[model samples]
Target: MTKKGGSKHLKRLAAPAFWPILKKEYRWVTKPSPGPHPLGRCIPLLILVRDMLKLAENAREAKRIIFDGEVLVDSKVRRNFKLPVGLMDVVSIPRIDVHVRIIPHTIKYLWYVGVPKEEVNLKLVRIENKSLIKGNRLQLNLHDGRNILISREESQKYKTLDGLLIEIPSQKIVQHIPLEVNKLAIVMDGRNAGRIGRIIEIQEKPGMSRRKFLVTLEEASGHRFQTILEYVMVIGDDKPIIKVSEGT
Candidate 1:
């Protein structure tokens, strides 16, 4: 995939089948785990897994934890959340991998966590994305340490990519893609883990065809049922509001 863009970037969207969703909601889904992992804040994954980290151990040990089924995204067990998740990605793991911060060379963006002055825009040699963009506050594990949250800033950072100090500019943090696609947030927590259904219709009035999404949720016990539940607006957000989930 090639195009005339501002900078010579790599990759389009991530591979469609790259992620494997869990069949059922894990019991630890609502345990209030930290979010926006450190790997997500620094840069895109292509740059992380390729270079930058100082890895001197056996390569397979690192690969198994990052690539295997240990990572979860948005309450679902995601095997490959590191492939190329952007601002739209939500990540989590079952039992907090306490060995995260000590992994050596993983840059993290932390919300509820602050960052130092010197660690921004650094490429990740073993992770997926590393160039810390803006609006990316992340919590990360760095080598036998507690999970940490840190933020990155804009500055002129130089790295010897091809033996030359490649001067890179500060990154801006702007999230929200497909900006037109309104989010269907889960209002009722703990029920189906907010993975119930998609919006089917929207109405300026009670009954109208103005619905947005038609969703199919994987209910517990592996049943695929159809319903129009998730939507952008609630029953009283506006006059004669359009409601998705019942009793809204």
Candidate 2:
């Protein structure tokens, strides 16, 4: 019988726009199927290990390392080479004592940020959806494709686009940072991503077909930029709840 379902190979030129690979370098690349993150926003685990991180020379080596039970994503060993590792997902190689968090890169649309081993358990998830469930429980749908339940009263304090510092495995929310002016934020999408800044102003334009909000971010170097509200993720009130320094 002929094989069916998703194709394993994708033309390099036809890959998603977010893919950082050079289209002319190779004719084909692995197309990661739907996993923990949306297809357009994620890269295959093999590509991340072999191409981006340069940890392995080829796909075979990457698979070997994964199958050896040496690769952990969000604190759980992941053997699937095609698994999607997207925004804010923690990838750790315990054997090498290397840990990284995938974030929007200032140059690449998405890039990996080296994180301290102690902070590997910390994750940032944006609240994308919420709904009331039975027993007065409120279900929150995070951007990471995770569904977590919180009390209705607690849900009332959270809104879409708010960032949460959650602990891995336990999935406990350590802090809640609201989206507002003067708050520390990070660009979660677009070219300016991974840049830490503070919200200087929020502009809501009226008389538009759909309501739109734009935020002005002032970087630590006294530089400023603007981005749509959806691109910003609140990280803290006074300081980041999790360590985000490059060397940390």
Best by TM-score: 2
Q: lDDT of each model, Cα atoms only?
A: 0.27, 0.84
TM-score of each: 0.21, 0.90
Candidate 1 — worst ten consecutive residues by lDDT sum? 159-168
lDDT (Cα, tens digit) per residue for candidate 1, span 1-248: 87663432223232121112122423211111123432323232222222222221323443454576654432344444234332222233345431111111112221111112232222111111124435675433321122323464412222111001111122122121110112232212122332323323323434544333344433234555433332221112111121222223
Q: Can you tell me which runs of candidate 1 are displaced by over 4 Å?
A: 1-59, 97-248
| Model 2, residue 243: C-alpha shift (Å) | 3.3
RMSD values, in order shown: 21.2, 2.7
Between which residue pairs do clashes occur in model 2?
116-248
Report clashes for each candidate as comma-separated counts. Answer: 35, 1
C-alpha displacement of 54 in model 2, angstroms?
A: 1.4
